[model samples]
Target: MEEWERWERRVQTAAHPVAYRLMRAVAARGPAVRVPRVGVVVSDAGLARQVLTDTEAYTKTGPGAAAALWSPVLGSRVLITLEGAEHAALRRRLGGLFTQGHVAGVCERVLRAPLGGLERRLAAGEEVDLVGVVRDGAAEVIRELVGLPAGGSDFTEAAAVVSSVRLWRRSLTGRQLHRARAALARLSEAAVESYRSGDESTVPGRLRALGLDEAEARGAVGLFLLTGTETLVSFVPRLVALAHDTGRGPDEITDALVEEALRVTSPTPVMLRSAARAGRIGGVRVEAGERVVIVTLLCTGAYGPFSPERDPSETAGLRRLWFGAGPHFCLGMPLAMAETRAVADALRGFPDLAIAGRRPARGVLIPAYARLSLRAAR
Candidate 1:
């Protein structure tokens, strides 16, 4: 395997050692495998897309779906937990929040100082821990999005909640659920205040203006805290590391390269849904109420190894399955891409950027480097 591919494997295995191996083993069995506890695992891009888009047979609100895990903490009204008309309506109202123009402006406002510091440090030949840089920048962006104050344990608490979840589990345990609720409630306090103020400058106020009740606005903040922060924290450093290890330079960091890296890394490696009705996915029978594990990393990995020069046609059918597909497609994609490009652009200033050191995060929900130290090549 290539050096970059090897390191990528290490990151995945470190975060989910048993689950990663089991997923690869399952993928080898076929595009779809129905394991005892894990339900039917779908590894083919087309099949994964089929299940994701077929809302009648599969749903995020079914017994073993994302709603079961997240709705308790984020509330039933949050977009991730709602389905059908409610889901569509919530997405429509929230859609204005994540437009390309608005997301770009948000990223610029929140990331400017941190990204500037990153460029300055690299230019001075100082080694920088990109993981920490990404964490701080992502935290600030999420805080701004949630209308929180300058500082708190927002990211840390949200990560704690996510880390408690396992692949095979349908829902968090009672204690886990309680802890998750408390953490989110703590993080949502400032957002609640902002929502009440109805100032319109902050995101919570904007949600209020968008006709979301206080509960829905609070749930939205919790959703952003959980989804928006860690994915960027997982992806940005890995993108830089992948570029360096693959002998690609700063000039190579384009939107296509970013998309390629996202496919290869698959930050949200697995997506969970439940069969709303008895159905067949990739010719495998799925009983109603069973879980459907979409192994996105494997689905995308089937195309080939990481290569920016690979024809766009190769992944054309996949339609960026990494972000997901259909109505449940990632609502924050613009913000995620904007943040990714901002970081990639910051690093582009250093043509000789090199990975000085790295360590993969262990026992976390997202596969990522615990520390990816970067410096200019002397």
Candidate 2:
């Protein structure tokens, strides 16, 4: 097979299996391989850091596919889009909200409320679709935190927005692209309204505290919903599935496992960056304005580099790229992690929990189950 064709085939494979394909590419051409218009994708973490963190060489560039969808919402300057000082400031401002106490408090509330109710239903011999249960739970935490109306439908609707964003970024056609933009705009407007009233203490409060005006708050909130929902929904079920497969009984399921799952299965795969200046990494030279997709999952585990034993904190290694790295690290990391762990712990308590049918869907960006069926303990 041709080199580029091999890469494309790899991209289409499952998350766990991507490493072998990556290793082959690294072997064939050594660590740095030309990914057509994407410049060079470095499999080495040190090299990736040089390319991504150097700032002078690589700039924060979204993948060719969703850049348009996101560019409008986050603009070319939010923490996700901006580089250097601007990105740092934004991250710092948002980081305060996810402090340990803040996250723990949210987790307690999540466990006490929706998650507790779901467990009760499951324990009653109810054939609960754990996917829907967990997805709705996570969605509620997000919406409540952000002040959105609850109905369970918002989770699916938000997922659609996320899916549309992915489709447009990849290969959406004219009409499809137009529809996606319209949907994003409508969602953005709704997201903004939830935070408008001074009485509301949603995510908009944080944006307002940051001094963002109405439109800026709308854009930020839209970005929050898009990015937040996908990660939590994707990880929550996988964590439960892992617990089921490992025979980790209620007693065995711990926050450690949840954090481990987050690290091991990084739902958010690539962190895209464009070269700011000419530079070389992984023994390959990159020119100015070149795009580089840093495969974060590859660096988190496997042969050498960033060992799990190195960081023994409650969720340290698990969150390696959980929020991403450099200037674009996620603003919602703390809340997402808290909610995911809470839901996982609650599900673990239901010993009879079994995934009925339907496998997960993997992609270049988002990864989750299309239909995660479930049945009562049997």
Candidate 3:
């Protein structure tokens, strides 16, 4: 394989924009452009729907490899990997906790936790690695929101260890897999203990009222944090980096710049689905058992046919799908977007912010800066 192809195969999951580009090329060109036997093509939205919505026909279950890799670590039934009524039931069960109002409340807290860290770094007259700052901040918020103990920094480290599994198609081994499972157990137990100790206010009252046994509730900690914290870590800095790289003048009205950045740099790349039943989609014949993916991040923005110029729609409304779509749409989207808006809004006051490194640092995945150091101007 060529170098770029190797990178594309190795690390780029749906989170990586390049994968979307490749898929789009195949879709537009025809099946012949893609590996014929692999059956990955993006040409027909019909084919896309087959993988995304046809839960019954495609059967997200395994004899296939993806499930075997993920089912043990991420519950076989977590929203992303689930199918049929099982997926619907879980979505409904968790609905009350992730309503708009609740998500907004969580965003408020996530936005504040990082202020002290950023301020301290600025006060010391040292350059800040925005990625590290954002990662730590997001990790802290996720643990606290899930009602986990902040006693040790282990939460962040454990989170990093587990997040590594996001690249499971490549480097995952039995040992790392075992660590991820154990970490989930630890985090879940802590969440259950915290809930019992008057920490019900941290999560939704309805969640606590669900009458889950301790272990079941604990198991949910990993699920919640995976969506809530990890997504923020991936997206927020990318937003900041885009704002900085695009040379949006600090005084050019922060809110507008933030909107542009969100539109320009959608961080979540791929949404996955299985055909509910065998049928045709986008004029493509989809076998009932096929898996399909939609690349919302890259395909929805100004680049694709869905350009905002012609669409004249606000990024916010359509941006919800940036989190996910259908019944399994992201539970933490409002919180994530609110936090992103707050972070960008705050940075607008720093008129001196500039790229600490090159403008467009390209990788096989999402556009990221090798170093996003901002010099907070006086």
Candidate 4:
């Protein structure tokens, strides 16, 4: 196989066996195809955009993945479950808190120490466990951003809560349900203090400022905290590996490197939507209750193999759909980019950085390495 093809295979394999098979099957079938009990898979970028943003036809409510996965913890009224006026009102109230400048400030304060430590260690030729550092650092940063108190144990505990629940998003065992509820309770308790003590600078504080009740504010805060934690944990280490493979970083090329890595890694690679009313996506018939799974991993990589630079076109399909499209685009785009940049910059310091070993994670929400050991080349 050619180089890009090999790297693409690694990306698919890293996402895990089930997801790899899912994408391959969807690709072979067509852009939009239905499967047994699974729903429609929109592998093409254009069709995926139509489904994700077509709120009138594809509701985030009803039997949607967001509702199934997030409603258990965030309650039924959080942004992911709300539709029409409620969704817009909630988004408007919380919008100012996540502006580019505000998010950049959050990243700087929350991630500076960790990024510095990584740079110094890598530059000094010390070996590093990229998975542990990024995973722990991601938890720390998200907690601080949401105004929650951080203890050393927060990382492992937080990850366990998310992971245990994530694997059973569609169907939960009794034990899994209990653990998820327990974790949500802890998060809500933490948010109480943050709401009362924190200022509008923090997310929970901003949630309270919007006049949401204590319970509502806590749910909103949990959603924001969970959004950044696991996804960044996956993105940081994978980007480091991809960067080393592509040999693009540090200099003027750093921005290109980060963009490409995010494109390929596409941290939260799948977006699931349930059809509200019978409709057609790219002319494929979809029924009212069937779910639509937007395979962004396939959409973004459709044009060709991964490259360091984004297409400088107003009509680029990958950019339009990957971070999502229309009103529901990712709220943490700036923060996500900042985190990716910080890690890429540090990795750039070791021009001869090489991955010593990597073991891919399975049966988790996002694809990532359980361990990514790295050493600087002499």
**TM-scores for all predictions:** 0.97, 0.80, 0.76, 0.90
Q: Could you say which candidate leads in lDDT?
A: 1
Residue-level lDDT tens digits of model 4 in 41-64: 788888887777778888777675
**TM-score ranking of the models:** 1, 4, 2, 3
Sequence-dependent TM-score of model 4: 0.90
lDDT of 2 by residue, 17-134 (tens): 5544654465356556776744577665566656655665566553442343466545554555566676676666666556778767756875587667777777776666666766
What's the CA error at residue 240 for candidate 3, in Å? 1.9
Error of 3 at 136 (Å): 1.5
lDDT of 2 at 188: 58
TM-score of 3: 0.76
- Whose TM-score is higher: candidate 1's or candidate 2's? 1
CA shift of 113, model 1, Å: 0.7
Per-residue alpha-carbon lDDT of model 1 for 90-153, expressed as tens digits? 8898999889998898899999999999888888889999999998898888788778888767
lDDT of 1 at 296: 96
Clashing pairs in 4: none
List ranges where model 1 is wrong by over 4 Å. Answer: none
**Worst lDDT window (10 residues) for model 3?**
3-12
